[model samples]
Structures are given as C-alpha cells and as structure tokens.
Target chain A: MTKKPLILVTNDDGISAPGIRTLISVMKTIGDVVVVAPDSAQSGMGHAITLNSTLYAEEVFMNDGPQKEFTCSGTPADCVKIAIREILDRKPDLCVSGINHGSNASINVIYSGTMSAAIEAGIEGIPAIGFSLLDYSWNANFEACKSYVKTITENVLKNGIPNGIVLNVNLPNIPETDIKGIKVCRQAKANWVEEFDKRKTPQGKDYYWLTGKFVNLDGGEDTDEWALENSYVSIVPTQFDLTAHHFIKDLNTWNLND
Target chain B: MTKKPLILVTNDDGISAPGIRTLISVMKTIGDVVVVAPDSAQSGMGHAITLNSTLYAEEVFMNDGPQKEFTCSGTPADCVKIAIREILDRKPDLCVSGINHGSNASINVIYSGTMSAAIEAGIEGIPAIGFSLLDYSWNANFEACKSYVKTITENVLKNGIPNGIVLNVNLPNIPETDIKGIKVCRQAKANWVEEFDKRKTPQGKDYYWLTGKFVNLDGGEDTDEWALENSYVSIVPTQFDLTAHHFIKDLNTWNLND
Candidate 1:
C-alpha cells in the first residue's frame, strides 16, 4: 500500500466557506488532509499575519475521511504559519488554498488572502497553489472547477515548483467544458481605481466605503486577464520577492551617503 | 506667501509611534502636514485593508505645530485610502510613511506596513515615500537621518515622482557625521529563513511564534543591502504594478486551449 500525500488546506473565506469546503472535498481523493483556516471571511486581506494577539486554532471537526480541521482566529497566511509551526506532524507534501469566491487575477494577487496563503507555503519551501473564480457571487458554480483543480494539484505534486515561486490560478465562471485547459500566464497590469462612496452617519458623522472599478491597463492577450476572458484557467507562477530588480543599477547613481 | 506643500502622513506603527512622531516633526518644517494613521500598531501587516468592518477616523490630537492629525481605525493602506478620499482638501503634494522602527530593506518591504502605506499612496497617483531606520529599538537614533530625510523629501516635492513610482528609503543607524549620503538602489535578492519557535500551552496544546533570520543572496554592491552596508541611505524607486510581464509570453505556449 502507498502512503497518501500529506496535504495542508486553507482559505481566506473562513473554514466554513463553500469554496474551502469544495476544495477539501477534492483533496480527500489525493491525500491525508489537515485544514487550518480563518474562522471568518478574510477576502482582500493580502498577506496579513498575526502578531498583536495570541492566535487561537481549535480542532473543531473530525471523522470525514480521517482529516482534522482547525478553525483559526488569524489571516490565511497566519493559518499556514500555525499549521507549519505548531499543528502539523510533518511538513506537507503540498499546500492548496482557496477556490475563492472572487477573482485573484492580475494585480489582485498582491492584495489577496487566497494567493498569500499559497505564497506563505512557498516561503516555507512547500509547493502551493491558490485557486479562485472569476465570479464574486457566493453561489457561483464551483462544480465546473473541480477537475482542473485536481489536475493542477496533481501536476504540482508530480513536478515541484521552482524555489521562491508558487502558483496563482484563476478560473472563469463558465462551465467545465467551455473552460480551456490551464494557461500559465503573468500577472496583468491592473489596479482598482477607488471611487469612495462618501456618506454621512445617522449621527451626522461622515464615513466612506472603499469601492472601485478594476482597470486593466494591459491589453496583451497572453496576460491573465486575457486568458480568463478567453475561458482558459490562468496559472501565474508567482514569487514572494517584491523587489523591482531592474531599477537597482539606476538607483546606484544617487548620492545617498553624502 | 507661498502655500505650504500639502503633505499626507501615515505609518505602520500606528498614529502614535515614535517613528511617525519623527516623520511628522520633519514634515511640518517642509509642508502643511495632514496625518491619518491607524489608532494602534500594525507592524508586519502586509498590504491588508479594512473590508469586514466600517472605518472611522477621529481627530485624535490638536498639535501646536502647523500639522493637523487624525487617528484612523484601519491598516496603513487604509489610512492612505481614507486620507486621499476624505481628509485632504486636495490631492497631497507628497505622501510620507514611517521612520519605521525596523528595516524595510530587501524582502521586508513586501511585509511592511510602513512601505505598504507608501505603496498604497503611490498606487493612487500620489508621489509617496516610505522611510525606515535599520535599528529596531524604540530609541533608534533618528537624529542623524533628519537632514537626509528633508533633502530627499524636498527633492521629491520639487521634482515629482514619475506616475506609478514611489521611493523606499532605508536609513542606516549611525551617528550624523558617519552617515553616508543617499544612493538610488534596487531591492536585493533576499529572504527570511523562518524558524518556528514552538511551545506548549497551559491547556496542553501547542502554539508557535514565527521568527526568522534574513538571508541576503545578492552579492551585488549595487543593491539596497549593499547600499546600506556601505552606510548610504538606500533609495529604491518602487512601483505597484505587480505584473510579471516577462512571464506572460512563456505562458502562452502552454497547451491550455488544445
């Protein structure tokens, strides 16, 4: 008998989110699973880790295929920290995060809990992948995404990711058949142009809800935004190093020490 | 009389950190300062923003100086968002963050509240910069950095930063006389080799504290790490476009559509 691969599962949408639940169901077919995830939704919480308060991760559920689950009071990145440092018996063979309710394509990867979890695992030297749906609706169809998720996870398990790199996978909301196979792409040049909805409080205090339109400046058909538009599952091999290395030589000209 | 340059101030160490105090003091000499920062410390909070909770910015202090201040209940990025949308009478001439207690050089910038606030402002079309001291101690010597900070800020104010570009300035901890001038540099290839310090809880459970030693892999004297080592204030021109444009072409070769 072969040993099942150890899989660490997490998500930004809390432990009970339908996205993680679906992901967990898929993982059971491939490995021995351990889940450590936020107790509540943590969408748009890019790369946050807990330091101020004591993290609380309780083993809340068991008996579903011998997998243990912990509901954690931390960000998705924090969940990965606690799992690797305190909870897991050994390092995971793979770390998979999300089937997120919203898109994490283009520039959104920088501000995404889904992708951050994957990046955290990559930092720990574990191969990881983050999956997200183009649809933001809670009831969006995830059934269409299962096979591709399984395939990508399997491919990662077979061929390890390069050092300092992880995978950022975004799926379109179309049906599985309409979905083309995964296309490895780069993060698109995009950003949210915030249009703050300024309103007054009932007590006459002014407040604002941070809202915006995501603008894609990159028109390249090879970009993630373009891949998803053409119904392909986009896979961006992402890294944790945020350094803009190309600008280093130009900066050396400044007389900083004088 | 010439109108004072409109300066927006924020920090990762909350509105009340000594770091921001030093930053606020310096900015007052150069501009009409408007401070909107988190009410509590937000160290190590990487690019997180408030969404689940409503944000509130209160007039926390009325100072004797020309600067006005507000304490916000949000992350460093949120402070920038709130300031740009509501607090400022017009777009700020320059946005400055930190005098951060620890280093934000190399890989730390990705996980820095100080730098992220500046990055957030830069993303929103504001000319911004994040400053840091190499020393982590609260009593870190900032006096030596005063003139350099003012010079850099003034040059930036006089010659606006390019659209979508900001600055990441790291000051070496040393005496004023020993300090070298500033250098334009690039982020070094570096990482934190995290060592998890695990411990047992009172209830017989286990928990862990995340700690690490940074490993600098870039041997180039032209990098930020090298700049700091040479006692120069490292100024890396940074941008918020997270697109990996180089990787897009390779992704198009994948057999996704077939």
Candidate 2:
C-alpha cells in the first residue's frame, strides 16, 4: 500500500475564508494535507514577499479538519516560502492555492495573490495549481465545483505537470452540470482599463481610488477568456519565465556598442 | 526637426531614492521627462497594485531639474497606471523604470517592483525598460551607468521594442572603464533558498525574518546571470504573457473532464 501524498494547501484569502474552507474539504479526501495561509486577506498582492519586516506564523485551530493549519502574517508567496522552509518536515507532493474569490484568467494572473502562491511553489519544483471562481463574494457557492476540482487534482497527480509550469485554473460561475468541462487554453490578451476615482479628504488632501473595467482584446476561441465566458473551466499552463525568446535577434540588431 | 520625446520615469525604490534620482537625470537629457514613483520603498512589491485603499499623489519639489515629479502612495504598478490615467498630459513615448539599487536578473524579475513598472508600461503598448545595478546599497555609485543608460534608451527610441515585450537590464557594480559593454540574454533559471530566522516578540509570540541565498541552477552562457557576473550589462527581453505555449498540447491530453 502506498502512503498518502502530502499536499500543501494555501490561498490569497485569509485562512478563514469560505473559498479556502471549501478547498480544504476537497483536498482532505485526496491526501495528507497541511495548510499555511495568510492570517488576513492578501488579495492583489502579486508575487510580493515580506522583505522589509518580520513574519509570524502561528498554528491555529480553525476547525476539526484532519489537515494541520497555520495562519501566517505575510503575503501568499511568503506563506508558501515559510511553509516549505520552516514549517513542513519534508517536500510536499503537490501544492494547491486558492479556490480564490474571483477570476485570475488573463492579465489578472500578473496581479493575483492566489496565482503567486502557486507560482512560488512551482518555482520551488512542486507540481502546483491555482484555482479561482468567477464569483467574487464572501458566500460564493463552491458546492458545484467540488467534483471538478477533485477530478483536476487527481489528473495532475496522475500526470505530472511539465517542468517550470503550473496550472492556472478558472471556473465559471455556473452549475457544474451546465459546465462544458475543462479546456486547455492560452492566456488571453486582456487588461484592466484603470479609472481613478479622485476625491479630497476632510483635511483637503486629494486622493484617488483605483478602479478598473476588464477588457478582452483577443477574440481567439482558444483563450482563457473565451473558455470562461462559454461556461467552461479554463486551465492555462503558466510559467515564471518572462523571457521573449523570439525577439532576441531583433534586439541584437540595434547599435548598442556605439 | 524631431520632437523631444515624452519620457515617463518611475522606480520601486521610491521617488526620493538615489536610484530614481539618477534615472531622472539621464531621462531629462533624452526627453521632456515626468516622474511618478512610489512615495516609499516598495522593493519586493512585484506587480502589485493598490486595490483596497485610496491612493494619493502629490506634486513635490525634489530639485530644480526640469522634469516634473509626483510622489504617489501606491505600488510601482499603480504609479504607472495612475500616471497614464490621471497624471500625464499625453501617452508617453517611452517608459523607463528603476536604475534600481539591486539586481533584477534571472528569476528575480518575477519578484521585482522595478521590472513590474516596466512590464506595466509594456502592457499599455509603450516601449519600456527596467534598469538595475547589482549593488543593493543605497549609496551604490550610478555614475558609470549614465552613458550606457542613455545609449540603451536611445536605441529603444530608435528601434522600438516589440509589442508585448519589455527589457530587464542589470548592470554590474564596477567602474566605467572596467565595464565590458552589453549582452542580450535570457533569464537564467535561479531561485532563493529561503532561511527564516525564528525569534520571539516581547509578547512571547514567535516571529520570523525572511532571508535567503540566491542559487543559480542554470549554467547557460547566454543568460542574464552570466552577463552580469562577467561585468557586462545584461538585457533580457521580458514579456507579461505567462502562458506556457509549449505545454498546452500535453495538457490537452489530460483526463480533465472524466
């Protein structure tokens, strides 16, 4: 008999969020689970680490779940780092982040705390996946997502992810039966068109609130945006390499030595 | 007669840091400059933006330099967004971030606030470059880098950066005469081996200070790490599209639905 795989679980949302609770419940059936997550919400943190200050992680009892849990005072990326470095006894078989409260589909992945955790784990050579729901509320229904999540997790364990890559999975906000299943896709060319809500404070100091509208510039059928829009779960294989290899020759032609 | 280019200058090291000050000086010589940077240090900010709070930007007099300056209460990415949306009179001809006090070579780009500003600008269809010195000190001499900075900025203006790409340039900490010119390279595969220094607070709470040693796993001669180590300025063409295009077909073969 094989030992149960030790799975590391985490999220951008605080340890107490409903989304993570749902994720924890699903993972408990699949592996020996250990969770280290932010003590408070760390949405939109990207790949930030706690470099300027100290970090604190205390083991806490959130529920009677079999999975060991720790609440960390750091970004999502830091949680993964501290868990692997100081908390865990050995390397994890897999790392899963989120079941995040919102979409991390296109350019949103660059600003996502949820994906950052997964990416951090991927960098550390762990097979990882970041899951997000299209719904962004405190009480978003994740009951419909449990079986699909389980299926994907099992498939990842069975078939290992290619080196330097992790899965960015986004599930549309619909009934699981209505879901058209998972589609392997590329990230869409999309961005948030920022609009600042400028205002003045009572002390007469001017301030602005960051707000944005999501815009999809790519019309291709093979993108994450299209899959999510058509009620399919999108699994985009994401990598940490920011290099644009194709453009190197062109850049080389520039007269730089002069 | 050619119009003077409009250049937007920013940094993760804050507006008052010597790094951005050096960048501003170089940029002023090339164009009509505008500086919008974070009011405080944001070293490990990555691609984060201020979402949960109000952002404030106040025009400040830093020096008698011709460039306009605004110190913002936000991350590096936020400075670019707010500049493009609320500050600048027109879309900038070029956006340059950093002259960062530390290296953003190899895998560090993923956690770099300096590169994030440049990537943010690239996403907005602007030709952008992020410059960093290997030296992490506040007093790292940037005197030797001025000519190289000007040359690279001019080349970007002359030969535009490809769409969906930006440059991550790292300079070695050596005298001007010792520098051996520039090399176009790929991001080396490297990561931090994290060390968490556990300590106790006065309240008897255990805390950790995050520290690490960077380990370069790739020995490729055509990598940014090699170039920087050899005392050459390294320029890696970076992109924001995180999609692992090569792995999509294999992911499609997974048993995701069943």
- Model number with the top lDDT: 2
RMSD of each: 2.8, 0.8
Question: Which number leads on DockQ?
Answer: 2
**The 10-residue segment with the lowest total lDDT in model 2 chain A:** A58-67
**Model 2: per-residue Cα lDDT over A1-258, one tens digit each:** 989999999999899988899999999999999999999999989999899999999899976587899999999999999999999999999999989999999999999999999999999999999999999998999988898889999999999987799999999999888998889999999999999999999999899999989999899999999999999999999999989999999989989986
- Give candidate 2 regions above 4 Å deviation: none
Pairs of residues at least 3 apart in sequence or in different chains that clash in candidate 2? none
Runs with alpha carbons beyond 4 Å of true place in candidate 1: A1-4, A198-204, A255-258, B1-4, B158-160, B193-220, B245-258
lDDT of 1 by residue, A221-254 (tens): 7788999999899898887665566655554444
CA error at residue B238 for candidate 1, angstroms: 3.0
User: Model 1 chain B, TM?
Assistant: 0.96
What is the per-residue lDDT of model 2 for residues B104-147, given as tens digits with 9 covering 90 to 100? 99999999999999999999999999999999999999999899
The chain B TM-scores of all candidates, as shown, are 0.96, 0.99
Tell me the tens digit of each residue's lDDT in model 1 across B82-127: 8887788899989999989999998788788888899888887889
